[model samples]
Target: MTTALLLIDVQKAWDDPSWGVRSTPGAEANVARLLAGFRAAGRPVLHVRHASANPASPLHPDQPGHGFKPEAAPRPGEPVFTKSVHAAFLGTGLEDHLRAHGITGLVIAGITTHLCVSSTARLGANLGFAVTVVSDASSALSLDDGEGGRIPAETAHRVALAELRGQFAAVQTTDEVLAGL
Candidate 1:
């Protein structure tokens, strides 16, 4: 199927360890796999970057770190959405860009499994586009009290995967996504 791969918010902003929600382990490798697939297929690989209202945060629109990481920077002609909110469509022309290319399907891969990834997945479904949430390619930070109390990252990741599967978007592993697309 000819579909756009929306690499949601895989920026240095979210990569900060201070954030409770960052890339899950192996996330870089997973994103690398998805990027490779999209490149091979000659499919559009769109990046969603957030511009937080907080001026001090690395995600501020004017901050240099608000862009994509070097590993997955958009190539020439690739679309990049600088969103002010969780959903990429909330404050950007991402929808119009997709429509212009006749993209009716989206494969999502990015950071913060519970934030931008989830929000955009719901919107993508509501917008009537077929959506797939790549399980391995997205991540949320592990919860911890630092007193030897913490929820396992894998467990939290599994929960996000289950939640997005039947609702936000169809959840699948990077390999599954590769096979489908």
Candidate 2:
């Protein structure tokens, strides 16, 4: 099957202190590794950047953080789909681009595993695409538990991967994905 590497929201904005502590300190390295693998294999590589609508968000277009992180930066030929929401596919024409390129499967890695990564994987699966999420190549920030408690970043990341595994996408480590590539 023809597969593509989709890196979502691996941007400088995620490094901002306001986002809280993030799990998976090695995620950016893993993402870079995956990018190298895909490039070596001559497969497609797509990027999804979050252009937050909120003016105060670091991801806002006017912010310096809107730029991609060095490890996940797109090369001249790679396609970048900018979005204003959690799901990369929403109004991004990502699906159409994939279809046009004959990409049937997607290997996804990104920042904030429980948000953009999860949303994109679910939507991709529902749209009939085979999606594999690279667990070690995605990070998540600590979150409010909605009960006066806080969910640790590690716990949140693990739970998000657990929820997507065997349902929306196949969750694998960076090593596994590299071996496959």
Candidate 3:
């Protein structure tokens, strides 16, 4: 089975301190490592960039932070799918591209574990793709617990992975995926 890498929204916006502390300090490094591995393996790579419509958001197209992070930037000729929605497949033609390319397996990595990454993984599974989410290659920012407490970003990250385990995608670390490859 041919497996492609889907890197979702690894943008500079995630570095904005306004979002608070982020989990998985090594996520970008791991993502970079995976990117290199995929390139070495000659596998297809798809980069997903989120362009938020909200002007105040750092991810807004007009904002500097909307640009891709250096480590995740696409090389010339690499396919980049831009989306405004949380799911990379939504209105992004990602599904069509995967179908046309006959890609049945996906290795996903990127920012905000519980949001775009999670959403994309779930949708990928729904579309019948065997998905693997690299845990150490993705992260989550601290979140409001809604009970006058804050959830640690790492805890939230772990929960997101736990939620996606088995059903939506197989969760693994970057090292594990690399070793398997």
Model 1 regions lying over 4 Å from their true place: 20-23, 142-153
Q: Which candidate has the highest lDDT of all?
A: 2
Per-model lDDT: 0.82, 0.95, 0.94
TM-score, structure 2 vs. true: 0.99
Q: By TM-score, rank the candidates, best first.
A: 2, 3, 1
lDDT of 3 by residue, 1-181 (tens): 8899999999999889899999999999999999999999888999999999999999999999999999999988789999999999999899999999989999999988999999999999998999999999999988898999999999999999999999999999998998877
Q: Write the per-residue lDDT of candidate 2 for residues 1-181, one digit (tens) a residue.
A: 8999999999999989989889999999999999999999999999999998989999999999999999999999999999988999999999999999999999999988999999999999999999999999999999998999999999999999999999999999999998997
TM-score of each: 0.87, 0.99, 0.98
Cα deviation at 125, candidate 2, in Å, is 0.4
The RMSD (Cα, Å) of candidate 2 is 0.6
Which candidate, 1 or 2, has the higher lDDT?
2
Task: Write the residue-wise lDDT of candidate 1 on 53-150 in tens digits.
Answer: 99988888777768788767888888788887888888799888888889999999887776778889888899988889888888876767479997
Q: Pick the candidate with the highest TM-score.
A: 2
Question: Pairs clashing in candidate 2?
Answer: none
- Candidate ranking (lDDT, best to worst): 2, 3, 1
